[model samples]
Target: MMRRQFFLLPLMINALMACLAMALTNITTDQHALLAFKSQLKLDPSHILSKNWSVSFPTGKWIGVTCSPRHQRVSALDVSGMRLSGNLPSQLGNLSFLASLNLSSNSFHGQLPKELAQLHRLRYLDFRLNGLTGDIPFWLGLLVELRFLNLRNNSFTGTIPSSITNMSKLQVLDLSNNPLQGNIPEAVGSLFNFYP
Candidate 1:
């Protein structure tokens, strides 16, 4: 009986280990998404996220990162006002779980990456006060969860995509300072009038 119990103990331990491994895998994927975003964006020069960055266990407490409890997945990335310069990285799209992304008040210049449309969970995106220019990617309308979108004080130009109307959850839309032209989408006026 002692030998039989010993054999069963190993089987149970192996099963438990397998379950733990699966959970860790899911957590790692989430963490990777956040880390990828951090790596893609340009950071400040004060060694803030400059060196010794780790996305696992107790290390994420460094700076410019906010993570969840259990899996340590990043939820918000607020790297605003850092004067950082670089093109918005396409890798940012990997952060599908991000709720808020604030790269405002920086020197970032480039067309908005189309991949950003993949952020289905993003609620607030503030790219105002940057140097971003080009036709606003129509893909942005795909962000169904977005509420506050501030692209003010930038160089974005071209007709406002009618797709902007797809953002049903949007509450605050500030494009006042951009170079966008053309008649405002009628759907937008019907849904929420900005002018009396």
Candidate 2:
């Protein structure tokens, strides 16, 4: 019994090390993605991200960033009402573990990046009161986990995508104040907690 136990010990240690290495790699990836996002911000009026989001500090410790206790990965980011102005970066889609993202009441402009469709775990997304334009991406429906979606007070045009009904978990959807055409999808009414 002692011989068998000793033989298995090294194998178990090696396996544990491999898992740790993979976790570390994922952590680095998240940090790089955040840095790339910060690079595109043309205006950070309060210097919040500019001073806090840096290699000098851990990514999870950065302001507005939240890390998951179990996975040690970024799970939420809320920079709302910061008055920051810039185009959304595609790098944000790299946050594979992100569940909630709020950037409301900012000056962010430009079309939503299709890369965001990669965030399959996303649940709450808020971009209200921004200057974002272009037709709302139909790919948003691909985020099957979405519960709250707010794009109000933006300059989005075109009809609301009927594909939005694909979000079976969706509860609140605010597309109001846009120049959208066509009636809201009849299927959207089926959503039990839908808010027009």
Model 1 lDDT, full chain set:
0.77
Q: Candidate 1 at residue 125, lDDT? A: 95
lDDT of 2 by residue, 132-170 (tens): 999999999899999999999999999999889999889
User: Which candidate's lDDT is highest?
Assistant: 2
- Return the lDDT, model 1, position 177: 83
Error of 1 at 165 (Å): 0.8
Query: How far off is residue 50 in model 1, in Å?
Result: 0.7
Q: Which residue pairs clash in candidate 1?
A: none
List lDDT for all candidates, in order.
0.77, 0.92
